[model samples]
Target chain A: MYMSVAELVDAAKKTKKPIYELVIEQEMDTSHNTREEIWDAMGRNLDIMAAAVKKGAEGEGVFSKTGLTGGEAVKIKNYRSAKKTLSGDLMMQAVQNAVSTNEVNSSMGVICATPTAGSSGTLPGVIFTLKDRLDLTRDQMIQFLFTAGGFGMVLANNAGIAGATGGCQAEVGSASAMGAAAAVELAGGTPEQSAEALAMAISNLLGLVCDPVAGLVELPCVKRNAIGVGNALISADMALAGCTNKIPADEVVAAMDKVGKGLPSTLRETGLGGLAATPTGVRMKEKIFGKAVDAKA
Target chain B: MTVNYKSVFDIIGPIMIGPSSSHTAGACAIGRAANSIFQETPTDIVVHYYESFAQTHKGHGTDYAIISGILGFEPDDSRVPYAIGLARDQGINITFIEEPEDSPINHPNTAIIELTNSKDGKKVTVAGCSIGGGTIEIRGIKMNGFDIKPKGPLPILLVPGSEVDQQNVTDQLTALTKVNEKKQYQSAKGDLFEYDLDRRLKPEEVKELAKNNTNLVYL
Candidate 1:
């Protein structure tokens, strides 16, 4: 198995194969599944992601049970339609798509966890947005997922992709890095450039904490996904333009692991610190779950 | 260090209904694992949520997810939202208890489930932890006073028939794939044997085994 980004890039360069092909071969070797079976499974994931993006973008806005988060994606779409966004149409469209996926997730709709459900929106935000801009075919879209998965596997194994384990930097941060790497590949950058994108994306969000307000995957979580998408896009662009990270991608992942482990427990999805501990956050929690839960908090 | 992630799908998928993968999808998977080990329709089930699970069970729909899993629903099943009412309709007495804040559990997202088949008075207790990314680790199982902890999250095949059937089942399973661990226990129902395999069995292989051995249980 390709356990590190350096190893993945080295193998890709040696064999003259794209990272996605190496990942597919690794999957086939470990899982004992044929290429067709693996492709079909990833195809199913793509369909799910597309359905979620469509539902979030076009369907009636959904509200979570606690009413903490909802309708933001639709609101963004409406605002984009009525006025010119400062972030430009493409970036705003990506933001809308990312927020829509997370909104669907908040309302308990089915979503393919890009790495984890909490950061599900970021990768799809990058994928679908690029699909429209690049006019990527179905197979290219599938390859994008494979490339993302390839990098994600390394990050998860070498660091992690769980907020509880390594804070939001590990969850949304890893998703962003993976998306950036995949975006680079889809943009016709080299494997080394993909690694550069991955390193830059992760290092940019290295110390980010998992501070969901009121312990819900709303508030900062939904907005962070938008930021993640933007981070992935910008990093991908930089990598494609021949920018490089001083630190190697594998070392950056290791540093992220160290930083995440060093973070206090409160900053690690415990719901007792950061925005979750803010007065307004506590009040929102009380409004939804009632006053008794405040004592526990 | 050992790599926990094995496949691309492990990183990208497990299409699921979720607000949180750890709280919702992982909890559902733990419940499903416990149900699979239980190997029978439970008349009564009591779930004990600890730590992170207790803190956010309501908002994340973890309670509903766990119930849906115990009802044999997959993580992506649309019916996960209505699981509680469905359990009630099935005449299953389900109760959820949040452990006290001071309760000492190693993992943040842990759940202990106790299930009983009221008709036959068969009982099983399973403890599992949601270890993120829509994955779970079945910590251990308690049946007839024996605590069985199979290695990690390997595929488990439980057989509860007779002492003679143990050798036959083990032989059959060993021929098909590598058996990592095997244990035997005596219960009120009969002699129960457990086999943990190094890898998952193919659907056809499971079907063939089940067809040959009526008492075979695959988890």
Candidate 2:
């Protein structure tokens, strides 16, 4: 169930008519503040377990490592990866590299969202900013979280979040779609608008892949969240504004399935395709993982 | 009536954790967040399961997620259902309302999960949407009938700037009000509760904290 590019583009073009009583909002905290909030909190939360990580590494503790907690975790989440070193934190660093560098890979930025862990950061970066204006109580925020989670849940159940299996469209595409839907709801758009936002957002990033270099979550993944948030917001608003697309949301997901299946295993988070196949990728893996896995047989 | 058709996906098991992370794990996360949000933890719950979740909820472990979430269970908890039972033992009334099947469509994964401590005469209503893969978003909330989505546009940032004429205010709020009528605009040019967050939360300080793998669930 996936919408084609031409269908989405054509429908998106109609959004310019602006029937949604459209309103856009921005809040600043840090660069890509929404995703950063999670990352920063991840960073701060690390402090709680600094002694724990050390203790685990020291053998006093076996496999126990402490981590970020609450808002602090939300804050520095993206940057928690060891930036000073060449070998960045795996999941976060992969995301950062995708957003920061121009290595020219389709594996670049994606919108992370929902239970849609693959695109988790996609909506938070966008919605939290809108949240700043809503004066939402902790309870309200929880509701917003719940609302977003529901759509993500649907995506996960219907489509797969694993890029290796379902592909990038399942991961990032779903996230962006969920993000947009949530944004529309929080923005006071009708449920119809919310659905439209989600469908539009999903159709936009259908058929992306995971395939981070070194089989790590770093690379284009980090910044992808930021861009995804932006796209989610734009497309969501477009959806809410009575802009109808020819391709339905389910069609988009199906298209993603097709694309993901067609992708080479190397491109599906195997660390064999995309940037992971590059010479720098092999070097990085050797430096970090200390293993030489070939890009191909 | 001319019906604008919308595609639908049913019984989607979110891809995050299990059992069905969005239904279970992410529900737990939101449920837990709700527990901590209230001035006091809810001793009762009025739960509404929209669409498919209502039908297959018990099997999906959604009841456990809500109960355990109220008790603040992590997504990976083996004792989640136990926690829900605990809520029952503690006299926390759990009412699950299923939306009429074949209801008008919106976000397929949305639900209205409400919590209340009837004994205390307090209530919290949460409107949430769960995405695939155990992720969640809170769309709105009604606490004692207080609406929470900022009733206006342009999230006011405390970046500190000089006064600007209407032409210079090129913010989303401005653009929204000028064109998008449906947008609720909140004038936040001067609201700075966390002014000079250096005195409050600092970047370096935040960086110092990220070392741990603590999970931060958004409000």
Candidate 3:
């Protein structure tokens, strides 16, 4: 019944419990599942996420039939190792992890959707990066997922989560928000602060469209996940530094829903507008699919 | 309206092989749903892709995913990549149609599957959509105009056609196990009896039910 972000935070605060713990309690009460069972399931998800990250980072990424994505993650990793990037070590690492996961996704590798498969990279990217920086235990990492899940459920229930329904703002935007909130909670910020982080993260990506080149998630989708990682980290840091969102988390989600609805169908994963319709995108499609649409180009 | 998400798994995971959840995993589930609608294994299938699905199915591997599903493969099965070749080897005739832009269906990730049972020459058309995150909704079934959305873990069966005794079938299944929910649709062709059981019925039991009722469809 308590489905709003504010309500979830309030419940957690009232119980003097972490948001993740409250979510655990709620899951137990509703599903009649044992804590061990829930933890085991989450543990499996983490294992898969970890394995995909490792495989992608190691340059063993499988190729999409379109051949648009495969080894970019390894390229990023190689770049990070050779140079000192402007984003610092942790951010660069996060970017590498994010790209790796999304590349794995593009290659048809098994991945856990951190909301949806299109947005899977953001949470794992930020989490793995913070795992080393924060010295988080495996159990704590799982709890971070729960924390993210808690807010994700709220956003999904309130606004939406699918790209086709709400544009990339729904997929990447919601994932980034969920990742930011979990990052805040992991950093020992208050539940309210976590909500602020979520708001900031989502607000930053408002009006973003789901315009993949050639209508494949490989092109801008994989790279956008890399950006989402940095977006989450920055939002988390801002929230930790006492930055506040003027519009609350729930309202921001509602606004995002409205904006997504207002987007043209072409901008919402239809492949008819934005980057998908660009001349280069058309050229790439022609190169991959050939001039099949025309008798002869 | 709230999406019926059973668990956090609904949010974070389906553990699927994918480039796109809406196009791949969910499409596989829709294919599975289409498979379930058949009385026996379908030897022929004609799929009509709609909107975005028609535009980018190849890039997202929607066609492969659906073919794999028709072959009774899950979304994560490695065989999904080679589903077309496998189906060809199995002697299944496959065809595709790009639904016109003015089609009545509105969902971006939608497909209408026409399946033919080789043995009986029975046919069924399933209009389904991949609603993202490996979830699917069977928007309609062409036999008797059934509008069903399968949301449970159990395999749902749709006995379409008026000749079959709907009450008797429901009673038989309800006697064997609790029927979680039941829905019915009356169309010009027949009465569609849809039942959601608490668990999958035993194969032998399903055989008995099918053997007894000629008009029964299992979906």
Candidate 4:
């Protein structure tokens, strides 16, 4: 509805312009880069993310990857004395309850901040990767996290990362987008290149939701951050390789808001539309009732 | 030629360093704050540990966060691996030391910073904390045994030890009593302003007109 001829671009330039083709205007830009700077940024962010996840697995806060505390480990060890197949429910439960994400914004305190509760794993997951996978020094990782945070801070102000407002696209999508942008910057991509990566992330995750099973953060959310982090890295790689998105990060954020507003409440966090009323949920409810009746006996 | 959206990425794409955006992101703000506090690149730094930042410092990469701050590392610089070595190469000595078990405890994320630049005999002690979301509160800093309090609205942010340091260090602190301060941004509302006929603007804009504009004038 809004139209400015020159603001849109000249008719002659429009014919010559293509989304990816136009990004090469770096010469006229002031955001010059030294190749080494970009690599360090990516390495640093990955380190911090990995470290955060490792911390969560260490049993701080609610994340206890090792479900078998001292009280239960001894009993489980004795019962499985002949442990040949190495099967244990405690191990399974630990995996289930351990090292996941949140449904709303969770606090990392002194560390980097994650988005919605459901995708809390995104930032920390990347940090863990840097620490275990790469040879990044401790300090470099810290700098990288700061750079990545700078990217996220802009988005946190510009975009809404909740399903209730901007949908899963805003939550996981924004995180992925922010990750992609930081990765690009770390790799020496120009500001425009970083924004393109962010755009791709937001567009890819458009229409995502915050539906959790039984209203618990345990299901789907944790895995989503892992996926989102991977996706953002991929997008950053693509952006760095000269690929670009047509939409701006700001525009995509606006679109996310519109889509979220259009989504039905049932499709949001409401249990009615998603996994809440699934067969698993029904079975769990039935088990609860059966246990209550048996206890009366 | 017409500029497209992807064109921007051609200049500045995003970075990929860590998991959480704010924690990792806020670290940059901390670095920036520390950098501003210390005028020159720090040669040596000791980040005192707090219980909250102590246990999780490693996991959150808090150690790296503060180190870059000392080295005057920019938020976008991704070469964090080389960062430590670069800092060392630049004669910047950085280390993390936890408080003694017997010492009095304070905020968990609080840090006691000791920055030394013996080249010019500039030694400073800054105690502060990176309270989440990139917000930093510099409780205080000392040049020597004497505390050099900030006199103006903004605490003395100058990293001292030069001739200017001695002159700026006042024996007594003239604490701000009660005076109207200017707003960060200009508007008809948020901050106090004069609504006189001679609408005063910025120093460049309003000029001394602001001093007389009784409505907008703090006096």
Residue by residue across B85-147, what tens digits does model 2's lDDT show? 787787777777667543222334456667777677878776665544554555555554444
lDDT for each residue of candidate 4 in A180-207, tens digit (9 for 90 to 100):
7666655656666767787787788888
Best by lDDT: 1
Candidate closest to the true structure, highest DockQ: 1
Per-residue alpha-carbon lDDT of candidate 3 for residues A140-228, written as tens digits (9 for 90 to 100)? 99999988887887887677777777888888888899999999998999989999999999999999999888778888899899888
Better of 2 and 3 by DockQ: 3
Which ranges in model 2 have alpha carbons more than 4 Å from their true place? A1-113, A291-297, B1-219
List the candidate 4 regions with Cα displacement exceeding 4 Å: A1-51, A55-112, A131-134, A282-297, B1-219
Q: Name the regions of candidate 1 deviating beyond 4 angstroms.
A: B1-3, B101-105, B157-198, B209-217
> lDDT by residue for model 1 over B1-219, one digit each (tens)?
224566788789889997989888988888898777777889999999887777777777888899888888998998988999999999999998888663234677788899999999989988887767886767678876566665546467877777776676777777786676778877665677778775567788888888767756676
DockQ, each predicted model: 0.61, 0.04, 0.43, 0.03
lDDT, residue A209, candidate 2: 63
lDDT tens digits, residue span B163-205, model 3: 3577678778876756767777776666777776544455677
Docking class of 1: medium
* CAPRI quality of model 3: acceptable
- What value of lDDT does candidate 4 attain over all alpha carbons? 0.45
Between candidates 1 and 2, the one scoring higher on lDDT is 1
Q: Rank the candidates by lDDT, best first.
A: 1, 3, 2, 4
Candidate 2 per-residue C-alpha lDDT over A1-297 given as tens digits, one digit per residue, 9 for 90 to 100: 112323323343456422111111011221223544433333332222122212222222121011100122222333363245343333233232222211111111122224333355454445444545566554344345534544554455456565545556676676677667766766667655666777778777765665555544445454456557667767876977789656766566666667766776556544557766689866765665445223212
